[model samples]
Target: MSVLGSLTPLPAADHPELLAEPVVKALSRLPDASGVLVAEIDPDLADTAAFCEAYSSPPEFSANCVVVSGKRSGEVRYAACLVLATTRADVNGVVKRRLDVRKASFAPMDEAVELTGMEYGGITPLGLPEGWPLLIAPEVAAAEAVVVGSGIRGSKLAVPGAVLTALPGAEVVEDLARPA
Candidate 1:
């Protein structure tokens, strides 16, 4: 119940204006969507650090979502990763091997935004493309509740952490990330 700071959150489905189009659509299709909550914030404070500092939310209140990409043969593959803000995803080691690519790196900002139909700083795993992988660190999937981006800078979403593991193509990987 207490995921983010003292700021109260509303049912995400009840406040479509706070979410991006894709985020809204994704939530609408989930039967467990009732647990998702949304909180409005100053757009300028949308980034993790600023939002936590300003809202009194703990620094680790949420898992951070990042997009990574790698190419294999003539095809390129992309995946979304969720790790604690205090940790960094193992893009070069575990992830590269998982994707079956020779190398892997963070996806370019513009490409990420365009592909996800979401704002750059607010890219989230909830509404990724159908075939993309969703690699989640065990730490993130085991949390009581996870607060993450809403696909827009003006708001954030919170849901039971286990919920993420059930999303399509979500894979829980140990050491998906290492402490920063």
Candidate 2:
């Protein structure tokens, strides 16, 4: 069974009060979401293998979304939601090309927090501000299921890969990530 099937189904619009503010806001907008429990985790847990082992799930069940940013004409634009595990976001090549910027780089921490309303360690693609570029690796889309942040540190949300694509502003692309 998919991990999402095994999780407790909380009201999609009602996330725990302990959740980070941005995650809570995002969950409020997604009326059909659910959450799964994980052992308390640190903020910088970026690797899926580590997260899965800590959460006691298969690596493929864990999805990691990175927010990449670049500057143009002294203004910075950010892109969020790179891929699941095993793939790294191609910020300088594919993503730069997609954004039509001459020089692109990952958004700095302060800007990332300000723009997404997520803490440095807990950003999810679900409730990103309108128009933030959301790139999904094709491999992730091919998965039977994937797990993403619940906008909180201690929980995750598992859903069909297709459901992720259906989210507002999500764009599925080929070779969207660099191999880990």
Candidate 3:
């Protein structure tokens, strides 16, 4: 893969090149995740737009992971959703219904980063908390390959769409994302 800069292709399961505990732990549990590739990045350019622009990776080849939360039975439930960079997660509609909550919104940045042990812009589905559903847009799950966060802003991961769909608790949803 032609990455923007020097990217060390590290194994996704071990992810020794990655420093986030939750990310490493989560990846290790995926039996078919061995093909995922992890690469280092300039933390300042970790956001999807900047990373894609600087690295020349088309937006269609990148996927973004977002955390959302809402109250279900008076208890807060959080879920991670994945969508292509060309689209946005349907938080209020698809996400809310899937979460079984009256309303759903993106989790507060601080809460999401702290709870997931990931940087704000680098939160990924590979290492989310247990019981949290990982909703992926069908378009993203059908792509041959995608670039995603590595839990920390300093790095990113590249893996096949099938690998993401195979992760524990991952659910492929139609219209999960809306055009950006």
- Among these predictions, the greatest TM-score belongs to 1
User: lDDT values of the candidates?
Assistant: 0.89, 0.67, 0.85
Cα TM-score of candidate 3: 0.92
Winner of 2 and 3 under TM-score: 3
Compare the candidates by lDDT and give the number of the best one. 1
lDDT of 1: 0.89
Q: List the residue pairs that clash in candidate 1.
A: none
Q: Write candidate 1's Cα lDDT for 98-133 as tens digits.
A: 999999999999999999999988888888989899
- Model 2: weakest 10-residue lDDT segment is 35-44
Per-model TM-score, in order, reads: 0.97, 0.79, 0.92
How do the residues 52-157 of candidate 2 rate in per-residue lDDT, one tens digit apiece?
6654666656667888877778777777855767667887899988777788777777877788776665677777888887889887777666777656656565
lDDT per residue as tens, model 3, 134-170: 9999988988878999888898888788988988789
Colliding pairs, model 2 = 69-105, 69-106, 69-107
Candidate 1 deviant stretches above 4 angstroms: none
